[model samples]
Target: MALITRLSTQSESFNSALRTLLAFDASQDESIERATADILKNVQQHGDSAVLDYTQRFDRVSAPSVAALEIERREWLAALDQLPSGQRQALETAAERVRVYHDHQRAQTWTYTEADGTVLGQKVTPLDRVGLYVPGGKAAYPSSVLMNAVPAKVAGVPEVIMVTPTPDGVRNPMVLAAAAIGGVDRVWGIGGAQAVGALAYGTQTLSPVDKIVGPGNAYVAAAKRRVFGTVGIDMIAGPSEILIICDGATPADWIAMDLFSQAEHDEMAQAILLCPSASYLDEVEAAIARLLPTMPRADIIRASLAGRGALILVQDLDEACEIANNIAPEHLEISTENPQQWADKIRHAGAIFLGRYSSESLGDYCAGPNHVLPTSRTARFSSPLGVYDFQKRSSLIHVSQAGAQTLGRVAATLAYGEGLQAHAASAEYRLNLSN
Candidate 1:
């Protein structure tokens, strides 16, 4: 149970608390380089053989061969049809919502020409191919399929390939159903570093992908980091996290339940609350005590809350905002009367849920926003996974004679300053041609 407070504190103290709360060490146990390198080598050398070996070793099931790796479109569609109408409707609604939101994020190819005839703009192109890795360890998250694939589909990616671990050598029908809704081109019953390797290096069955995106365990994060240059990745995700800022009007049970949601994700997951009132903190603590026993995974939540989670009492709303900004939490909920007013003070956060009604779970499940967010305070730099993850941008430049003449001298001078004779000569030649 967390005890909240509204106590005044120094800016430095608030910042320190924020750092303590949000600080996540990227460097951890497990040599992903060595692990990924060894796995990549095996996959590169043996291709499907290595993938099978790892699948058996990690997932405890033999992987489908290259010939049988891809699930047919008919199989996928049938799986969708087999789902209960209510579940099918939910999947369709979620997919359509995701598609609609991401559709707005689609980048367009644009070219702007100045009066001087200097054409400068950005050309956005979808990757020829992409691979999404979904974790099948827990319950199958069809939402993940929608989150990762719909963005790519919206981005116009030609082929969106998917991989999920299958421990029983059986694909979850819901997983297949989600794939169908998201327009995934292929679903492979393979997972872990081997799947990442297959996506990066291309096996006898799976085609190499330009980029891979989705959430996975620490090993998956490590594999993605290891294969970074070989293939693009979204981000080295950290454990799930949630932070709440409350003035205490909301029920403590609501706050406690919300905290429990993130805490149950993993032992390392974090749940924190910043409250500006002592009475509220006390109420939340009581509510947490009452509610935690009801959850099936209460042990996981209790461990996470006791370990990484905390209740901070701030003196004022301004201090609360400072702490929130410093923490740069993955999920931030401002449960205050003037949530919008306080939300403006938050400078760093992956996603901000304004008001008491905007619960974090909504964003995790049905809210159109993708739940794949920056964690471990990486919100300070990165963003949630979205359509932009599946697209590449190329700079477009076309300089007319006049534009070249006007720009080439400066270009040549800068190139010469850097002691690059070839670069200077190229620019000088263009300038001379204009003359």
Candidate 2:
């Protein structure tokens, strides 16, 4: 018996089976929602006192004040300096690559004058401050720190405040090192709904941030969803996903490991392979069986594979690409000869890795592109986190005397048609005025 489900596009039931496999209930847990709301309200009302109380209860670390929870710059620098040479070099190199990649995504202000002498353009400006939420404790992700913070710095964000839970009051040094390398301005020993609240509503000690970005558990996701209007938030990411379109030319063992990479993230993560060869699918399944026992996270891989993973035999490479477009996976790997040809056909994907050697893990770590990507089919409409996420644009309009005379009549006519008398009068007032 195979650990992952096998499907054939020729089968009549394939469409229904695929739908069942793709179904993920994203509804918020009512109990968790209520709990998160209470935390946000308490934090908003009592300020730092409420944040401290929740931090003590949830994280088991009591602090004299929220200000005391601040992790100083010296500690971050020390963490970076004290890391083993290899680890320090890796962090520095990854940060530099991420920074360089995001630099190209920075938006600039531009203006153009009309023939009538009216100037219209856009003003691009970075957010004043941003808050980054990092999952901590046993699940430290220094990669996430670089992915979130480096882009903001590249966008010219003045301050990037990071909040991570120091469970049992022990901080992850790698996370601290990444923060130092990524240009974070402040760090706080905090997490959960309270952390989101502190960033959104601002306590006495912590200033509010313009936007919050990063991944967290259920309560944190709910808090971000609830406080969206109060402060901007990145998308509520779902479990990680990877869809591999294989030509069966790549080694079977390599494909198996690629599937395992996303499966190890969690039991809910999805991994799927689409290929035109039935024999190739069989070989990959055999590889999975042989490799499963050797992995440290074999149990998680097993569960995720059994629950959502699939080996789909498509009609051909063209059909495989079509199916992949529908899936809109977080990561898409085209493992074939001339992978770029298939990549050119792909309409939606958070990230695309071309060729056999271009592994998804490389992109996740140091491939010079943002690893913070859209998940759960959001790739169809959204984009990867980049410098653009941290900067905003303001429309610039400077009307010359003659231009306003021509524009005001059009504006007044539209306002009058909408039955807005005051609006029409306002536009009309500017009309026929001396320069």
- Which number leads on lDDT? 2
lDDT by residue for model 2 over 44-120, one digit each (tens)? 99999999999999899999999899999999999999999999999999999999999999999999999899999
Kindly provide the TM-score of model 2 when superposed on the true structure, using C-alpha atoms: 0.98
lDDT (Cα, tens digit) per residue for candidate 1, span 252-294: 8889998998999987899988887878787887888888888
Candidate 1 least-lDDT 10 residues: 1-10
Clashing pairs in 2: none
Positional deviation of residue 247's Cα in model 2 after best superposition, in angstroms: 0.6
lDDT for 187 in candidate 1 is: 82
- Which residues of candidate 1, in runs, are more than 4 Å off? 1-26, 31-34, 432-435
lDDT, residue 337, model 2 = 95
